[model samples]
Target: MFLVLQLAIIVLSFIAHEHEAIAAYVPDYSSLVFPIHKHTDAAKPLYSVEIMTAYVNMQYLHANFLIDVDAPFIWHDCIVQWNIYPGSCPPDKLCTSPVSCDEYQCTDVRTSYSYQKPYCSPPKNESISPGWGYCSCSVNVVDPVTGSCGQAKLNYWDDFTVNVSNGKNVLTGVYGVYPYAACAPSSAFQSFPANVTGVMALSSSPYALPAHLLEPLENVIGLCLPSTLSTSGVLFYGNSPYYLLPQKDVDVRSYLSYTPLIKHPDSFGYFIDVNNIVIKKRSISIPANATTKISTLDPYAILRTDIYNRVIRRFSMVTKRIPPAKPVPPFGLCFSTQSGLRVPDIDFSLPEGKKWTMSAANSIKQVTKDVACLALVDGGATSEPAIVIGSFQMEDNFLVFDLENSTFGFSSSLLRKQTSCSNFNFTLVES
Candidate 1:
């Protein structure tokens, strides 16, 4: 018994030593702190500086900020409808035709370019309208719901309030107030007895209504940063320039000079860059295996979407073990398993009703997964295969990634501030 106890003591001693070693070598996670500050640049007009934190795994960023969904507030008393299955091709419109004449399987294409759509015969193909009906999903933009819908809609505004978890004190009196006439038609409106939760005024100076982070799918009345200042360009619907003014302080009459930024305008996708914002691109180095094809990748570029041709999160960690030997995915190829890197985008449609209810259908869901980042094991020999990560839904926009415990986080670089800050670059190895 004495011998056994002695042996146990020796094992315990070793474990203690290991723990101490780990404590010493574990990267000071505190060093990874994100810097959020109040900006008072009237020329730039930025009221806040939301500095994104750097992480070993980019997934954390996506799960926390990018993939966030904003629930539309109840446009009190507003009545809205959507057209889900706006049927087939219209008359005078040419449909796809397969051509055997081409060496490869080819789809013969015709559009306004190839065929001039003539006036259709009355009552012909009446089921097919000249234009697709706009899809409308109910938004709780003012009085929000318990959960936002996931399925896509052509037109909708999800009511969302910023969740100031870590630093509510910084935004002492921030308040979110929209013009009553903003959502006119009045029939489709909703009013929640509760006031906006994350509302605050950077300063109670009462310049006008402060700009809210416009919902991705909403018809943005205006953008309110602390001011018009932008470190990076503000993204909008049509990639067109839009004016930024405090919503509370400005008048809609002045907006007549500038075109309102429309979401999903007659076309599908486009990018909007705000004026005066200096957007810098961040380049992170990824590892290439011995057989990695460097030529296939844009060696200097960092966008996973641009290089890999898919929406994904990139992670780089320094592990004690070599990454499992595998063929990195081919550049510009989509993953078959529907997994690679996933960058989260805001889905403002999630429901967050009156209470802190988790059971609601639109409750915040935090989705996370163990994703792989670009690595350079042997200076470009092979690429890594996509891994199936996990996801979770949270009640608010803030996401937590516990890298110290080995689980990872996810995020996209889309909303990150571009900078010459090289600390954003990383290298991976076995822990």
Candidate 2:
């Protein structure tokens, strides 16, 4: 772990009843919450987005999903066959019904880059179920990394809860949000962690997870990614007043700096403007209109080859005095931590003179007891997205994505407040 950070555990109270309806048991006012867990994979990072969902084989499922802000629609690893099966719907799915091809929900898929129009099942095969045969919605489920896709059909999920927090000490689990729409892929292109199933999409698309869970409150997401596997991060699905407990007086939003979020017509990820990169007293000038995307799927921040070389060159010069350690596999540079080493913070200079500073904890990664390396990697060379901010740098940072106003808010590091993202109080309050 970079610095002192701890994320509270998000307890999931899943309802296993035969049929649970969300509309009957949900409160009008309350911010939905989830605890984010970092998995044990060191080679390729896998952050767990916990959930209980429904599909083909399983009656009930306790699954792990990736929190991908870059994806449009939510999809899972379930097999979907072309021909219709008589008894495909599980009991958990009985709470909600499948969407119809003639419905507006299916038409909305036409507007999405992540989905495809499902050819209406030839008139010969009478409709067995709403989404199965007659004009079902076919999809191209986007993988977070390669951008390649897998096949799936439009599906609705039930059994996901409607737990909410007061942004303080109380988190109450309402009945649940039934019929939340998602997709069922034939096979997930990306590898999963153990029981991992799919992605918790928080993209800008109207079909994302947040879109299905839209409430009467502010359209925003407050997220804190944890740095350590021993702890977990937190998510707030609504506007804030997101409080870090024990020190409830300190609201995480108070420290955020705002920047306009840029949208790509072809992509579903969030993009930001970066004037240049700065290290120590040296300022490395980048293209005037250079932009970068923040990704939860990328384990390490990636810079263009040229930009990465410049950063490593500058860093090497800055700490040239320290003894160098043996090179790690992916990391080009390493320093002997046993002899004591210090790294200068790297800054992604934003417009309006605002800088998204990367603290040493985020700037460097401790690969081994005596070895430490820069937490950045090279993404070949591309000007379209000169940088891709990764999960390693996002740990313990309270990020607020305001979709309503098209803005991105960030808290540099929660450790600076003497608390971590784990400070949220998930304990239930008695009515």
lDDT, candidate 1, equals 0.21
Identify the runs in model 1 with alpha carbons over 4 angstroms from their true place: 1-371, 374-431
After superposition on all CA atoms, what RMSD does each candidate show versus the true structure? 29.4, 12.1
What is candidate 1's lDDT per residue for 1-431, written digit by digit as tens? 99999999999999999988876662211111112222222121111212211222332111111111111211122222323232342322211211121212111111101111133211111122235432222111221122221111111332222211111111212112232111213222122112111211211111111223322212221111111122322212111122222232322223222211112212111111111101012222222311111110111112222222222222212121233223343322121222333322221111121111112111111122332323212212122221111111121111222212211111112123121111111222122
Local accuracy of candidate 2 as per-residue lDDT tens digits, 1-431:
32323222121223433225553565544577778888755347768777655434644456677888876777665533344356664433222344555767666664555433243222121335545455555555655544554555666554475456777755544536543444554256445565566777788777777776665557899889888877768888888588886577877788899999998767778999888889997999887656689889888888888888998899999989989988796788889998787778888888798888899878888999889998888777764588889888998888999988999999887787788887777778753
TM-score of each: 0.19, 0.81
Query: What TM-score does prediction 1 earn?
Result: 0.19
Given candidate 2, what's the lDDT at residue 201? 78
The lDDT per prediction is: 0.21, 0.72
**So what's the TM-score on candidate 2?**
0.81
Clashes of 1: 116
**Residue pairs of candidate 2 with colliding backbone atoms:** 6-422, 7-422, 8-422
What's the CA error at residue 87 for candidate 1, in Å?
Answer: 48
